[model samples]
Target chain A: MTISRVAIIGLGLIGGSIGLAVREMLPGVATTGWDADAAVRRRAAERGLAGTICETAGDAVREAELVILCVPVGAMNAAAEAIAADLVPGTIVSDVGSSKRRVGEALAKTLPGAVVIPAHPVAGTENSGPDAGFPELFRHRWCIVTPDHTAPPAAVEALTQFWEGLGATVEIMDPAHHDLVLAVTSHIPHLIAYTIVGTASDLEDVTRGEVIKYSAGGFRDFTRIAASNPTMWRDVFLSNRDAVLEVLGRFTEDLSLLQRAIRDGDGETLFDLFERTRAIRRSIIEEGQDDARPDFGRTDH
Target chain B: MTISRVAIIGLGLIGGSIGLAVREMLPGVATTGWDADAAVRRRAAERGLAGTICETAGDAVREAELVILCVPVGAMNAAAEAIAADLVPGTIVSDVGSSKRRVGEALAKTLPGAVVIPAHPVAGTENSGPDAGFPELFRHRWCIVTPDHTAPPAAVEALTQFWEGLGATVEIMDPAHHDLVLAVTSHIPHLIAYTIVGTASDLEDVTRGEVIKYSAGGFRDFTRIAASNPTMWRDVFLSNRDAVLEVLGRFTEDLSLLQRAIRDGDGETLFDLFERTRAIRRSIIEEGQDDARPDFGRTDH
Candidate 1:
C-alpha cells in the first residue's frame, strides 16, 4: 500500500510541487521528474524537486508505481499519447489539471492499458515554474479524484492516499460534476476577471495610468486573478468550454439584471444583494476555507 | 500653519481612522471626535480614538480650526447642516467621503463660513467602527482634494500638511473630475464585485456552498470588494450615478465581446485578452501600487 516510487511528468509548478510535497511527507520515497524544458528539469533537480531527474518521459515513469501527468490540459492528450507506450502496466496515472473530464477521457482513450486516476489538486497561484513550487502548496487544499467505473479500486485507493498524504483533503466525484462545479468556481471567475481587467487595460491614456496606481480600489483584485498563468487558463476555458459558457451565460444574465437595478437607482435591490454576499464571506471564514481574522484572518499586518 | 486642533464628525471607519492617524502622527494635536450614535462615540472614546469625544457635532467643531466630515455622502450634507452654525469664521472644513461633486456642493452650500476643501482618501476596509481604526491606514494612500476656487490658500496648505503628516500624498483636482476618475477606478469595480458575488450566492443551494468553499479561485477577491461599507458604497453609486453608469456601460460591452469569444471557442481571443491584462498587473507591481503577492496586495493578509 505504500507509494515508494513516484514519477512526476512535468517540472512546472504543480508537478514540481508534487515532488516536493511527497519528499517532505514521505521521506525515503524515491522520486523521478522530467519535463520537455531542460532548464526547468535542471532547476527541479537543483532545488530537490525530485530525488532524480530522468532523461526522458519513459525513463521517468519506467519503474514508478504512480505517474502524475501535470501538464496543461490542452497538451494533456498529446502528452498522454506520447507516454502511452512507455507507462508500465498497473501504473496509476493521475494529473493536476483543472478540468477533470477532458483529462480523464484523454487518458482513457490514449493509455487504455494503464490504470488512470484523473485527479485535480484544486489549488494554485498566479505563479508558475519549478521555483514557485512549494512543498506545502497542496496542504489542506481539496484534491478531487474523478475515477470512472473502469478505474480499478486499488488504483483509486492508492492515488487517493498519495494525494491525502500530501495534506490534500481528497474527495471523489464524477468528472462531469467536477467540470460543472469548477466551471462556476474557477473557470468562469478567471474568465470574468480576465475580461474586466482587459477592459480597463484598454482605457484612455490618463485613466489607464490611474487604474494601475489606484488599483487598491478594487480593480487590482481582478488583475491578480487575470495574472494567472495564461496558457493554463486558456487551456481551461477551451477544455471546459461547454460548462464555462453555460455558467458564464448565467452570470451575464444576472449581471444585466443588476446593471438595470443600478441604472434605475434600485437601492433596495443593490443593498439586498450586497448584504447576502457578506454572508458568503462569513461562511468561507467558518468553513476554514479562509482565515477567520479580518482580511483572510491576518491579525496583524 | 499648524493644524493643532481638529474635529472629526460622524465617527465611523474614516472619522475614527483620521482621529487615530492624527493622534499617532502628531502627538500634541488636539482631536475632537463626534458621532450621532452615542454607542459609536462611546466606543471611540473607550478606544482613545481622539483626544476627546465631543457630546455634540457642534461642540466638536466650535473650537476647532479644522473640521473633517467623515460620513457617508448621503449624510454629508445633513452632517454639514448640523455643524455649520458652530463652525468658526475662516475655519477649514473638509470631508473624507467619496463622490467629491456631491460632497463639495454640500460643503459650499452649508459651510460657507468655513474654507471648504473636500477630500476623498482612496483607502478603507470592509470593517467599521472605532476598533477597526488604524493610524497606518492612511499612510501610502492617495487623498484627493477638490478645492473650491475661493478656498483660502492657508486653509489648503494647512489641510495638505495634515494629510502629509499622516504619510499621505495629496492630489488636487476638480470635484467633477474626481468623481469621474473614481467612478471608473473605484465605484464601478465595487459595484461589479457586489453583483457577481451576489449572483454566485443566488445560485442553487448545492452550488452556492461550493462557490464559497472554492472561492480562492477568484470569487473570494470579489467578496472582499463586495464586503466593503454598504451605506458608503450605496451613497457612492447614487451620488456618482452618471459616471458609474457610463463606466459600467463600457465594462458590459467588453464583457459581451468576451462572452461571444467564449461561446465561439475563440481560444486565441481569450488568450490575447488574458495576456494583455497581465501587463496591467505588471505595471501595478512595477509602480509599487501593489505588492506582487496574493490577496491583491493586502500585505497584512
Candidate 2:
C-alpha cells in the first residue's frame, strides 16, 4: 500500500478493529491509535490495537501518512481538531462515521489544507468498545469511501488500497448519496429497532419479563440491533438528520399501508409485501452479505 | 407422558419439528403427521419427521390422544374440520399458532366437545417447510400454552409434559393475554421487519442492489426476519388483528417520538432510550432467550 503510517482516533469497536486489521493485513504499515477515554486507551494498549497506543491524539497523528478519525459522527470535528496541528502536509484524513456529508464537511472545515477523504465501513456488531473488536470484522464487508471535490485521485486510491488490504471491498460513492443510502440501510433500521425495543419495554399489558422470555419469536432479533452503542447512534441521528428524517417518512408511510392492510384484513396486500420482502433477503444472502443458515446460524439454535 | 399417540396436522416447520423432537426425545410416543401439501408430506416422510407420515388428516388423528394443528391460523378451521370426525371423544386438541384467542376459539367451534388447548411455541427460524425442521428446534425455547375454561387440568398437564419432553419450558397463560404478549413479542416485530424490508426494496433513490450490497449495516438483520413465511405471517396479522394493531399503534407513537427527537437534534432522548434498550438485550441473553455472542455469532463472522 502507498500509505506507510496510519493514525486511528477513538479506540472503540471500529477504530480498534481497524488497528488490529492493519496489524494482520498490512504488517509493513505502522499504526498509532488514541482514545479520549483513558481506560479505553489502557485496554487498547493491552489488546495491541495498534503498533503504538499513543497517549494523545496529536501524538498519534504526528508522523502518520493517513489519519482515520473513528469517533462518533458528532465528535468528528473535535477529533479532527485534536490532530489538525500535528498532521503533516500531504496526509490524507478520513473517518469511519456512518453519516458522510456532515463528517466530510466537518473534517474539511477543521483541517483546512489537509486532504479529507471520508469513508464508512458498513460493518459492525451491536457490541462496542475495545474488547468487542476483531481483525476479521471487516472481512467480506463493504466499505463505502465518500470523497468530495477537495480529495485528490491518489489519496482516494491509497485509501481504497488500504481498506482492500484489510479484506474489505471498497465502493466509491458521493457524500450525499452515501448519507441517503445509509439512512435507509443503517440509520432507519437502528432507529426502528431502538424505538420498538423501547415500546416493548414500556408496555403496560405485556410485562418486560414476558417480552424478554418470549422474545425468540422476533423481538430478540431487534433487541440485538437496539443494543448498539447509544452515543454513536445518537450522533448518527443528529449528524444525518435530513436523510434519516426523509427515509423515516417513507418508512412511516409504508408502515401505515401495512397497518391499514392488517386493520382491513387485506391478506393479499400483506402476503404480497411479505413475499416481495423475501426476495430481497434471498438477494442479500446470494450477495454473501448475510448468513444463509436458519436464524443467522445462531449456535444456541 | 400420559398421551401415547400424537398427531401433528400440517407437516411444515413447526409440525415437522414436533415430530422430529418426539422421535428424538420420546422414543416410545408414536407420531402420525399429515400436511395439506402433498410435497411437504413427501419431504417429511423422507426426513422421518414423524413415525408415520399419514396420507390423510383423519388417518393421522384417528387413534391419537393429542392432536396439534400446525397449519396457518387462517387454515385452523379447515384443518380442524378435516380431522374433527375422526377425533375420539376426550381427545385434546391444540394448535401451534402465533395468535391464541382466535385459534382457541376456532378449534373449539370446529370440534365441539373436544378438549381444545391452544399453544404457541415462541421459537423458529426465518425458514419454513419440512426441510427446515430439526429435533433441537425447541431446545431452550419458550412454549406458551393457553388453556381456556373448557380445557381440563389433566389435559394441560399432559400437554405441558409433552413440550417439556421436547426440551421447552412451558408457560401457562390465559388465551387473551397470550395474544397480547405475542402481538408485542412476535407479530408487531414481524410487521415492522416486513414493512422496512419492503420500504428498502421499493426506494427509488436507493437501488435494491445497493441496499442488499451494504445490508450488513443493520438492514440485513431485518431481511432475515422479513424472509419469514408469507402465508404464516399474513395469517398471524389477520388473526391477531386487535392485539397486533394495538401494539403497532404504540410502536408508531414511540417511533414518532424518536423521529421528532432526530429532527429536533434531541440527543439526550435518543441516548437515554438507546442506553435503556441495551439492558433488555442483556436480560435476554441472561435468560438464555438469545445468543450472547456478537452478531448472533453467525458462522461467517
Candidate 3:
C-alpha cells in the first residue's frame, strides 16, 4: 500500500518542490514529472526535478503508483482527464490544489475508478516555476488531506504517510471545511493585499515612486503577497468563488464599521480592535506557524 | 549652531532610540530624556537611554539647544506644552510624529516663541516602549523633516544634520504633502490590516485556532501590522483623519472593482493588477527600501 513510484503532472513550484523533496527525503521512491509547457519541462529536466521527465501526462502516470496533479485549480479537470485512462487499476490519485472541495470533486468525476484523495500543503514562497522550488519548501509545514469517506482506508493511510515522509504534519479534514478555513486564512488575505496594492498604485495624490520608497512603513508586506503568480491567483479566486466571496463579505462589513469609527473619531473602538488582533499574531508565532522576529527578521537590507 | 545639548520628551521607542543613537553616533552630544510614566523613566535610566534621565519634562529641556517631542499624535500638544516654559529662547523644537500638518500646527501653537519643526522617521518595528529602543533602528531609513519656510536656515541645517548623524537620510517635504504620502504608505495599510484581522477573528464559521494555525499562508503578515501599538495607531487615525479618509475612499473603490472582477470571473483584470504591483515591490527592493529576500527572509522559526 506504500507509494513507491510517483508522477507529478505539473512541474511548477509545488510539483517541482515535491519532486525534489521525494528525491531528497524518500530516496528509494522513483519520481517522474510532466508539464504542459515545453519550456518548463526543459527547465525541470535541467534541474533534474525528477528521475524521469516524461513527454506526456499519460506516459508519466503509466508506472506511477501515485499520481499528483499540481496544476492550477481551473486546469484540474484537464490534468485528471489526461491521466485518467493511463492510470493503472490500483493507482491512487491526488493533487496539491488550494481549494479542496472543487479539486476533489473534479478528480472524482474525471477518474471515477481511481482512488482520489486531494491534498494541499500549506507552504509556498511568493515565487513559482521550476527554478523557484527547493527540497525544503514543505519541511515543518502543514499538509491537509481531504479524502472521500468511502475511499479505501489503505489508500488514505498511504497518502498520509507519503506527505509525512516529506516532512509535513498531516491532517485529515472535510473538503468543505478545508475550503472555508483556507478562504479565511489564505484567500481573503490575498484579495485584501491585491486590492490595497492596487489602491496605492492608483492614487492621484501620492506618486507611485513615493509609495515604493516608503513601503517599509507597511505597504511592502502587501506588495509581496500581491506579487504571487497572477495566473494561479486568478484561478484560485474563480475556483473557490463561494468561500472567498463569503469571507470577503465579512471582511467588508468589518471594514465598514472601522471606517465609521474613524469618521466618528471613535478612538476606543479602534484601539480595542487593534489590541485584540495582537493576540492572534502572538498565538501564530507561539504555535510555530510564523517567524517570531521583528519585521519578519528582514535583515537582508 | 550645532546641537550639542539635546532633550527628548516622551521617552518611548523613537525618543529612546534617538537618545541611544546620539550616544552611539555622536558621543560629544549630551542627551536628556523624560517620560510621563515613572516606570518608563526608571527603565530608560537602567538602559541608559540618555546621558541624563530627567525627573520632569521642563528639567529635560532646560538649557537644551535642540528638543524633540516623541509621543502619540493626540498627545503632541501636551508633550510640547510640558517643555514650553523651560525651553531656552534659541532652542529649536521638533517632533517625531507620523502626521506632519497636525503635529507642525500643534507645536507652532504651543511654542510660538521657539522654532518649531516637525519630522517623521519612516522606520519602526511593531515593538514599542523603552525596552524596544535600538541605536541602529534608523540606519539607512528615511526621515522626512517638514520645517516652516520662515525658520532660520542655520536651524534647519542643524536639524537635518542631526537626523543624518543618526544614520537616516533626511528629506525636506511640505507638511501637507507629507500627510498625504504617509496616508498611502503607512496609515491606510495599517488600517486595512487592522480591519481584516478583526474580521478574521470574529468569523463564527471558522474556529480562531484554525486561523492562527494556518496564518503563514498570508494572514500572519497582516497580524504583525495589526499588532502595532493600539494607542499610537488610534491617535494617528484621529489626527490624520482627512488624509486617511481620502486614501480609504480610494482603497474602497479599488476593492470594489476587485470584488466585481471576482464576481464576473474577470481573470484578465486580476492578472493585470497583480502583475502591476510586482513592479512596485521590485522598485522598492532595487532602491534598498525593503528586503529582497523571499517572504521577507523570515528565518526566526
Name the candidate that leads on lDDT: 2
Task: Name the candidate, 1 or 3, with the larger TM-score value.
Answer: 3
Total residue pair clashes for candidate 3: 0
Instruction: Please list all clashing residue pairs in model 1, or write none if there are none.
Output: A293-A297
Where is model 2 more than 4 Å wrong at Cα?
none
Name the candidate, 1 or 2, with the larger TM-score value.
2
Compose the digit string of candidate 3's lDDT tens values, residues A1-301. 8888999999999999999999999998999999999999999999999999999999999999899999988889988878877888768999988898888887888898888999999988888888988888888889999988878899999999999999988999999999999999999899989888888888887899899878878888898888888888888998888899899988888888888999999999999998898988889888988888778888743
lDDT tens digits by residue: candidate 2, B1-301: 3988999999888998999999989998999999999998899999999999999999999899999999988999999889988889889999899998888877888899689999988889899999988899999998999998867899999999999999999999998999999999888889999999989988899998999888999999999889999999999999999999999999999999988888888999999999999999999999888889999988665
Ranking by DockQ: 2, 3, 1
- Candidate with top DockQ is 2
lDDT of 1 by residue, B167-274 (tens): 788888888877778876778778878877876776673378778666666667678778877777878887888877777788889988877876787889888887
Candidate 3 regions with alpha-carbon error over 4 angstroms: none
Q: What share of the true interface contacts does candidate 1 keep?
A: 0.53
Worst 10 residues of 3 chain B by lDDT: B292-301
Question: In model 3, how well does chain A match by TM-score?
Answer: 0.98
lDDT of 2: 0.92
